[model samples]
Structures are given as C-alpha cells and as structure tokens.
Target: MSRTAHVNRTTGETSVDVHLDLDPDTVTVDVSTGVGFYDHMLHQLGKHGGFGLSVRTEGDLHIDAHHTLEDTAIALGSAFAEALGDKRGVVRFADATVPLDEALSRAVVDLSGRPYCVHDEPLEMADTIGGDYPTSMTRHVLESFAHHARICLHVSVLRASNPGQKPDAHHIVESQFKALARALRAATRREGDEIPSTKGVI
Candidate 1:
C-alpha cells in the first residue's frame, strides 16, 4: 500500500498545508513557514527521517510564531497518522540519540495509537534562534504533534551545551528534532505483516 497523506487546515490565526509520504520513490523536503529556523528544523526532520515532506504555512507572525509553529505541527502530525493508516506491519517502537556540536538529545517513540508526550530540557536555552522562533515553543510543537499523530513520544536534552558556556538554542533544538526524526523513521519501518500491538488494531 502507498503510505501518503495530505492535510490542509485554516483558522483565524493560520493557514497550513502538509504533504507526507512515508515510502516515497524520492525523498524530498520543501517547507515555507515564514520562520526561518522552524523551516530549517522541518527540513532536517524530513531529510533525516528519509521521507518526502512538504509544508506551507501562513500565520499571524506579527503577533508571534506560536500559532504558525503549532498549527504546522498539527497538520504534519495529522498527515503522519493518516499515512500510517491502521499501523500494520510497523516496528511500532524505537529510540534515537543524536548530538549536534555540544548538544545531545534523545527521543523515544511508540506508534501505539495513544497520544502522550513527555518533553524535558534545560531551563537555560537561548531565548530564541531566528528571532521569530522561540525556544519555548519546541515543547509545545512536540506535544501538539504527538496528540495529533496519536503517538507516544518522549524527548529530552541530555546535554545542553559545552561546559561553562551557555546553551546554544540552535544546537539544542536541532538535536531534538534530529533525534525525533530518526526515532520516527525506525518506529515507522515495515517489520512484518501484523499489527504490533496485542490488541491487533494499532
């Protein structure tokens, strides 16, 4: 079966569209969200996960990036869920640890058709990365994605920065996204022709 999905969402605060193909003939990423850092992160996600993904989002950036980031994640997560369908023949559980420069992050995922998220990070992350993308929104994005995707996700920053140096929000956040991407790639992999859960429906 082809694993692909598209989602379009519009609201008073934002308009978002996402297309995802878990098993694509050619992996590609195209993202435009008006937030440079967030776009870069999404690119990393698609590239590292070895999937084809695209996203276009227009939000009230004059107000903040919260709406755009969260809404985009919602759409992307919905697309992921739709692409997986009934989650048959999937690995269903995986974990990854990634490091970017001095930052190290870990992510664990379970495609158990349950929506839950646990995000842990240092309190001293840089305020923002690309001026418009706030570091705090990272957790919100993960939470929103997990909820919409109906997956159990856990992400943590094992190391924030080099000793005696302040946390680099860019590296910290990038590591988290990379780890999540890798974990998702593994968890979504085709393993066998059976649902991973004992319930036979996940």
Candidate 2:
C-alpha cells in the first residue's frame, strides 16, 4: 500500500499545499514558503526523514512570515497524518539525537493519536534569521505541526557550544529539525501488520 497524502489549505492570511509520501524508496524535497530559511528547514525535514515531500505557500508577506510558516506546518502535518491512515504496522515510537557543528538536539515521537508537544531550546539570535524568518516561530511551527498531526513530539536542544560563545542559531534550529525528522521516520516505519498500541488502535 502507498502511504501518501496531499493537503491544500487556504485562509485569509495564507494559502498552502503539501504532498507527503512516506514509503518512498528515495527522499525528494521541494519546498517554497517565500522565506528562504523556512524553505531550507523544510527541505531538511524531508531529506532527513526519507520522505518524498513538497510544500508550496502564498502568504501575506507584506505583513510577516508568521502566518505563512504556521499555516504551512499545519498543512504538512495534516498531510502526514492522512498518509498514516490507521497507523497499522507502524513502529509508533522512536527517538533520535542529531548534531550540527556545535549544536546537538534530540527529538522523541509517539504516534499515539493524541496531540502534544514539548519544545525546549536555549537559542539566542536576532529576532529573525535570514531577515524574514522569525526565530520565535520555531517553537510555534513544531507546536502547530504536532497538534494537527495528532502526534506526541518532544524536541530539545541538549547541547550547544562555541568555545565559550553563544551557539549558532542556524545550527541549533537545523539540528532540531534533523532530529525530529529522524524520529518521525523511525516511528512511522512499517514493522509488522499490527497496531502498536495496547488500546488496539492509535
């Protein structure tokens, strides 16, 4: 069976489309969120997760990137959940730790049909990275994705160092995304033809 889904969402602030294929033999990513940094991050998610994913968005950038980022995450998460269907045969729980230069992050995931997110990071950067992507929206994106996907996700920046200097913002964020991607990929892997939860469904 093919685990794939497509989602299109439109609101007064943004319009977003996402396509997700979880069982692809090779990873392919195409993302355009109008914010360069955000696009880079989404690409990392798809590439590291070993998924065929695409995302496109049009938003009121004249205002800000908040709506664009948040709505795109919601659409992406919805597409992922739709692809999972009944969650049968899935690994259902996984964790990963990833490092990028001086930043190390960890992500844990459970496909429990309940929405929850715990995001902790000690990143100090300018209000925005790449001039348009707001640093504050990092946690918001994770929260929105987890809620819409109905998954329990926890992400933490466990270590970051620059030889007594503050950590690099880009590395910190990228490591978190990489860890999340790896965890999600493992959690969604097909292991056996059975639901993983004791409740008989997830």
Candidate 3:
C-alpha cells in the first residue's frame, strides 16, 4: 500500500511530512535540518528499519534536536499506521538484542493495534541519558511513533560490557539502531504469510 502522513507542532517550531511504501527495495532518505545529531539518529532509524526515507526540516535547531526528532517520529509513525491499512497477514511480533562493545540493548514490537515503548537499555555516556541528549525525549519519540503507528514497542539494554567501551556517541546510537532494525525487520514479515494473532488478524 502507499501512504502519506504529516505532523505539525504549535510552537511554529517543527513540521514534517513522510511518504512511504513498505514494499520498496531501496529506501532513499534525504533529510536536512539545523540539528546534526538528529539527522544522524534518523539515518540510523531508517537504515536499521531497512526503510528508505526522505525528510526535510526547517526547525529552530539553535535550541536542540528535540523538535526535529519528535516530529520526525510522529510523521514516520503516522505513515506506518496509514500504510498498514488493516494489519492483515503480518507476523506482528519480534525481538532483538544489540551490543556495542560494552553496551547492549533489546527491542520488541507488537503491531497488535496498540502502541507502547519500554526502554531498559544501558547508556555509556551522560550525553545519552542527560544533558541536551534527553533520553526521556528519545523515549517520548519512540512512544509517539509506536502509538501512532498502532504498534507496541519495547526497548531494553540488557548489558553494557564496559564504561570505557566506546568513546563515540555515534557508535552508541548506531549499535542501538542496528539492533532495532533487525528486530523490526522480523516483526514486519508475513510468517507463513499468516496472521500472527489468534484473532485471525494482525
């Protein structure tokens, strides 16, 4: 199916639009915004999800990545919700645990007509959980994405092998996305092309 989705904010702060098709083989993402960090995160999400994405943002990034990230999730999630149509013949559940040297994380999804996010992941940098790096904001984005996408999501960091493990924030984020991607790919599949739920539907 084909779909289009959008998200608009009140602060005149953030706005995003997403166009997506689940069956595309080569996902193309063209995104530009004032926030570099957010751009990286979006790339990770798209790449890991095996999704081709294209985004353009005009936000007040002098403040931070908050608006950009959250808005992007809103749009992307809405697109997924729109595209799923009736959630027919889908696997509906998947799980993945990803490791970045000392840091490891797990994410599970249920496209079962509801949205939720649980993050039990570990972070090596204070930048991840605190500072402007807002872990809560990231979680908010995840929750918004899943909720609107009509999917249940759970993310956990089962281990962080060492604090001295990796010095780069990019590595930390990349590993997390990689893990998420693997899990999402599995969940989106049509197992035996069967409807995974006992209700005879997704």
lDDT of 3 by residue, 1-202 (tens): 4433333433477767666555567776656655666666777666767676666766666777788777777777887787666766666788887777766778888888867777654444446532345654656777778877888888765655555554455455556666777777777765554566777755
Ranked by lDDT, top first: 1, 2, 3
Residues 65-149 of candidate 1 have per-residue lDDT tens digits of: 9999999999999999999999999999999999999999999999988899999999887788878899999999999999999
| Candidate 1 TM-score to native | 0.99
Q: What would the TM-scores of all predictions be?
A: 0.99, 0.98, 0.81
Clashes in model 2: which pairs? none
Candidate 2 lDDT, tens digit per residue, 91-194? 99999999998899999999989999999998566578899998899999999999999999999999876668877888889999999999999999999999
Q: What lDDT does each candidate get? A: 0.95, 0.94, 0.67
| CA lDDT for candidate 2 | 0.94
Query: TM-score for model 3?
Result: 0.81
Model 3: residues with Cα > 4 Å off, grouped in runs: 1-11, 128-136, 163-169, 192-194
With a 3 Å backbone cut-off (N, CA, C), the pairs that clash in candidate 3 are: 27-52, 28-52, 29-53, 30-54, 102-160, 102-161, 106-156, 120-157, 121-157
